[model samples]
Target: MEGFQQQFIISVFIILLGYFFKRTKILKESDGQTIARIVFNITLPALVLVTFNQMEITLPLVSLIVIAILFGLVAAAAGFFVFRSADTDLKGMAIMMMPGVNVGLFAFPLVEAIWGREGIQYFGMFDVGNAVIVFGLCFFIASYFANGSSKFYLRETVSPLLRSIPFLTYMFVVALNIFDFHLPTFLLDTAEIISGANMPLSLLLLGLYLNFSFEKSWFPLIGKYLAVKYGTGLVLGLSLFWLFSDYPMLANTVLIGFILPTSTTAVVYAIRYRYNAKIAGTIVNITIILSFLLIWVLASFVAYH
Candidate 1:
């Protein structure tokens, strides 16, 4: 817990520094965009390549993936019903946006910081299902609503998944691990070097892209979305905490996983589908802030315990 507190405090400082730079115009929004692209295209893949290759797959790791996916499906179903009264676009968008966790950019860095490679393994495995929802289900929902058609093609749904560099790296590493083949040491070292940039750049990218501007009309819906997103996470996280009290690693993983902010990937979906990207962007920003506070509180409780 002391380790978590110290690391988290440093992490928050870096994030706030990013926000400060953007606010002061020391770094433009375009700079943030460029940094984000580098993260997604380069650094993140390196991190995934390094970590996924190194993880020792086990039943518990597999279970974490299963639980994450199940939680997402349940959340999506609930979101559909909750937003049933909205118009088709808003309804579909809300449903798609509400469920998936942001493990890559948000969870990984913090987990790696607090719990090191062990925590990364837990969350990375959990992201197997998360990638499914983010690159598959969420994309389809947004596309369906944007086009005003329910027609779903298997190719359309999966193309983005296959196209993702990090996704491909994950699959490649999984296959290698399963077959008992290891990456060359030189290659692994290169990946480690690149991945070292992932955490700071990612947090700074979040700050650079942070936006507070939104239509006043979006307020109520955003409020409801946050409640469903964080509230559901709270209930599920607390239950897992109690159930896995003896298993600190699993318990803490579940708790932190629940509080991770909305995926920046959602904004990508919003843009591609010509949906309300602004609202999606706003949610991303807000959730990051909310997740920090929530995680801090959770960490405090853990320390006291």
Candidate 2:
């Protein structure tokens, strides 16, 4: 636990430091989503594809990680319903729990920095598993909100890659890597530049979104969403950590996984489908704050034992 406490203290500092930078104008206000788009569409896909192509794997943990994320996503959805606090207005809240990582910004570098490339390899291993589940289920949520409202359209299968730029971006990268294609140096360099801008910029964009809230009429019910975000994240993540502790690979696994909340990926998708974009942003903002403490606790646990 000593290792957990020390690393947790440090991790919490970093997380809060981000919040401070956001509040103090150090992060500025403009260019949040543009950077997010760049990272999602360009930077992340490149880093992931390059890394996946480049890394040597002795263990095929990608499937395992995917299973784990799917389990978590299911549980998160269950929490949203069983807790039954916010279902009446679930239109805005469901997107927050979309399956994915804080990859690129939080998990990608954080895992690499903490556990090195091996960690990222494992992270990549699990990404597709989470992606399929999250994106697929997100539509279900969208359809729920569409609710005979004439806004919902159900696809018989996965939509075209063009339908999902972020997913396609990584899917494209992964395909190129698996096929052993070499990218032009100029393209690689461009990816590095855009991805480099994802973190600080995303944080500030978060700050701007966090500034908005439901109208005064909606404040009381906001707690239901807050409850789902923090409560499910902490309880589910920690529970998984404890259950998996006997497995050696559990080393750095949970910390590496929950680095950030459900990403704005859901928000972007929700907006495209017209479910409730602002609600998605609110969940992202609030979840990011809750995660500061939860991830620190989880990270400390991993760092130590």
Candidate 3:
């Protein structure tokens, strides 16, 4: 309990530190976008490529995927339950939770650090599941709310994935690992050093970036995001852990990844599709703020052994 509490406190502090620093007079608002791009395009990609690609596929890998997909479905159901009394209902809930997850370093590496290689192993396996359902369904839901037909342009929809150089690099790395295409130790060691550097640098940059936007943004939207997106996903995550405590570590990883705060990139999608960027950004921010509490309760339960 003590360790869990400590970890939770640190997580909350880091998030608040970012929020508060951004509110102070350190940088201009434009710097936030600059920092975000650097994280996404550079450091994050390096981390993903090294970690994700180095892992090999196996039955356990498949199990992780199954777990992620099932978790996604379960979360969707919970979101529906949350909004049952609302006029918009499940659609709103789905848009809030499913599509809003930050799948890259925002989630995967954090799980890795929390649980170790086993922690991130599930990330390599389940990230695909997270990608397809969370982002995919979010797009679908957005289309569902549109005035015309409900179907989306599949090509444009997956264009991001297609152009994801890091993801592509990861695929090759995994293929090599699975095929036993053993590389020199120096190469592996190099990957280890570089991949490991990603998180600290990116987090620092995030800190630097957050130093720019301290002013109040959108509290109401943040509140709604907390209630539906994070609130529903987190509750479902905790419930799943309580039930599957036998596989505590795996359960913990998947649930946290799902229950994690909305990715800021979701705001880009919201703006691109005209789905409500203000709402999505607030959801992302509040989710980041609240997830530490939910994750702590869950890790305390699941990692208790």
**Residue-by-residue lDDT tens digits, candidate 1, 1-305:** 67778888888888878888989989988897788778878998898888877567787778787788887887788788889899887887788897777888777777778777787778877787788888777877888778888888889778878888877777788888889898999999999999999999987876777677888998999999999898888999899988989878778878888778888788888888777888888988899889978988886786677
Error of 2 at 264 (Å): 1.6
- In angstroms, the error of model 1 at 253 is 2.1
TM-score for each prediction? 0.93, 0.70, 0.77
The superposed Cα distance between candidate 2 and the true structure at residue 268, in angstroms, equals: 3.9
Superposed Cα deviation of residue 49, candidate 3 (Å):
4.5
Off by over 4 Å in 1: 303-305
lDDT of 3 at 300: 66
| Best-matching candidate per lDDT | 1
What lDDT does each candidate get? 0.83, 0.56, 0.59
Error of 3 at 208 (Å): 6.0
- Best model number under TM-score: 1
Give lDDT tens digits, candidate 2, residues 177-217: 56777788787677666655544443434444455455565
Runs in model 3 deviating more than 4 A are: 1-21, 49-56, 73-100, 205-225
- Judge candidate 3 against the unseen true structure and give its global Cα lDDT, from 0 to 1: 0.59
Candidate 2 positional error at 282, Å: 2.4
lDDT of 2 at 295: 58
